[model samples]
Target: MINSVLMLLIASALSSSALAKSCPEVLDSTQRKLNAVEQVNLCDEFQGKVLLVVNTASQCGFTGQFEQLEQLHKKYQDQGFAVVGFPSNDFNQDRGSEEKTAKVCYLDFGVTFPMMARSSIKGAKANPVFTEIARQSGVVPRWNFYKYVIDREGNVVGTFASSTSPVSQDITSVIENNL
Candidate 1:
């Protein structure tokens, strides 16, 4: 009986560890803030929510979309949805420094959604999240503010180009359907 109990306890422990490791490796990585010391562990923090991941640049023509994105975040956030921004200089449009990027995003744009550190969003140097996103959507970001819509299960269900408005019906429909 003692040996059986010990075996059961070992199995239970192993199963728990396995469950914890079940999140997709592509989504399990940690993302740092653009200016702050804050970090977000993607899988641990946002596993069950619909994610709208956008590659952003402070000086891009689409910069005004930040306000619309924030509005979308607020509209659906209470229903298990979130918007994540990744500041990138892949197009040389950003402020060129984390501090300035933070200022543009947080202060100038009044963005309240999470903004990730500067990362390459295209080609081989792209961040893992973007790489996986592109892989799933078959669409590499053509410019800043490219949006990838991910479902609650971490699957990329749609890729919206820079021209697609954040408040467009297509985006909200996808988010609502996922929710």
Candidate 2:
């Protein structure tokens, strides 16, 4: 009887441990500020799908990535991929409020994907998600438009430098494989 009880207890503990899911090695928290951008639940946003989280700016040199990002979203959105854009003034690359920034993204790039609140994307005050992405991928952005690819299972699959174009074969291949 004692052995049976112990076995049952062990089994229960093991199952509980196995059921606890971990988020991607990148971006940390689901709770964060939502100002100009839409307030989003990361878990719900990417549930059962691959997500491309990019730190964006309105005035930065890499801003053109936004156009390519839109194209990627258009290409893969129907196939289980999403591009989550987070505007940041962390590097002073973004210069306006969320609505103000959205105007620029809309008029300049015609973005259709989700836009997130403005937050610091680097250093001590960086958004939890971006911080975790930097830690997991080991490729912190040197500038804006740095892209982090989250696999369908929510793992940090790759980190592209700010200069890495969204249309590059490397990024497209990942999208192709996952989608």
Candidate 3:
């Protein structure tokens, strides 16, 4: 019985490893939650979903976009859509701590989407996800709240500038068309 159990465990481990390897390399990245403690594998969590990714700052002029973003998440979530927010301090406008950023986003704006921990979102210091986003879209974020629309296949389909509102037809149309 002990020998049988050992073989079963070994097979289970190998099966898990193979399952993990099936996730594509593009979305195979771990990101910290807004609280800065828990981390999640993006591919494991969001591989098959259409994603609207935004680099956001609490104190920036574009901060109000969070409400519209939340609305988008609510409206399209059941249709395999998600809004992923990345809080960034690269613009010197973020609250400087996860707690305060959480308050601004979760409390003030009622943002229910997944918000990643604060990180640099520009230049060489940008996170690997943003790097690949820029590479695919040919448009790097010029300021806080610039958005990248990613399709279900993990393709960066569009990049919207900071001036674009989250609920604008230009943004939502692309999201609907992709969905």
Candidate 4:
């Protein structure tokens, strides 16, 4: 009961979006396609907030996780956190082009948070941002929807498997304490 009350208090305390914050020191100067938006300034786009980066795929069974991700993003957004999606075609055949894939995600899921371009999240061609995520989290995503949680200070605090939901206790704890 005390834990639940504490959670409520923390959630209430963090009641504003950090999306507009000045870009932090961690994000790089990389421009990638955002859902329907043309090349957006990545770092400038999401400067001050805590971030949850997930490698997503359209055809995967784990695709249903989008709803949970959206929930987490929406619930914690006012608290300075975001769920950033990276649609990848790396495994078991990804459907649609990069833009089309992102479109499907937005239209189907009402994903309000940032969704970046499709990229290889594994092997030799993985994007530098992801490589950095992996290097810090100490876990290369084995498949799509693998989550890397970045704290407000830009530390890669944790990595979760594809099986882990965005609302998982571990993830929630990280956001509550680190964000």
Top candidate when judged by lDDT against the true structure: 3
Query: Candidate 2, residues 48-147: lDDT per residue as tens digits?
Result: 6888888889888888788899998998899999898888887876886666787878877898887777887778987788777777777777778888
lDDT (Cα, tens digit) per residue for candidate 4, span 1-179: 99999998877666533443545444774646654456766677676678898988888899889999999998999888898888888885467777667666888878888887777888799877787787776788888889988887677888899998889898999888876
TM-scores, each model vs. reference = 0.88, 0.81, 0.86, 0.80
CA lDDT scores, all candidates in order: 0.89, 0.78, 0.90, 0.79
Task: Enumerate residue pairs that collide in model 3.
Answer: none
Superposed by TM-score, candidate 2 places the C-alpha of residue 153 at a distance from the truth, in angstroms, of: 2.0
| lDDT per residue (tens digit) for residues 61-108 in model 1 | 999999999999999899999999999999889966799889988999
The TM-score, computed over Cα atoms with residue i paired to residue i, of candidate 1 is: 0.88
| Model 4, C-alpha of 171: deviation from truth (Å) | 0.9
Model 4 spans > 4 angstroms off: 1-26, 35-37
TM-score of 3: 0.86
| Residue range with the least summed lDDT across 10 consecutive positions in model 3 | 19-28
Number of clashes found in candidate 1: 0
As for TM-score, the candidate ahead, 2 or 3, is 3
Quick one: best TM-score, which candidate? Answer: 1
Report clash pairs, candidate 4. Answer: 16-78, 23-47
- For model 3, how does the per-residue alpha-carbon lDDT over 61-179 read when each residue is reduced to its tens digit? 99999999999999999999999999998888996678999999999999999999888887888888898888887888889999988998788988899999999999999999999
CA deviation > 4 Å runs, candidate 2: 1-28, 31-38
Query: What C-alpha lDDT does candidate 2 achieve relative to the native structure?
Result: 0.78
Q: Which parts of model 3 are misplaced by more than 4 Å?
A: 1-26
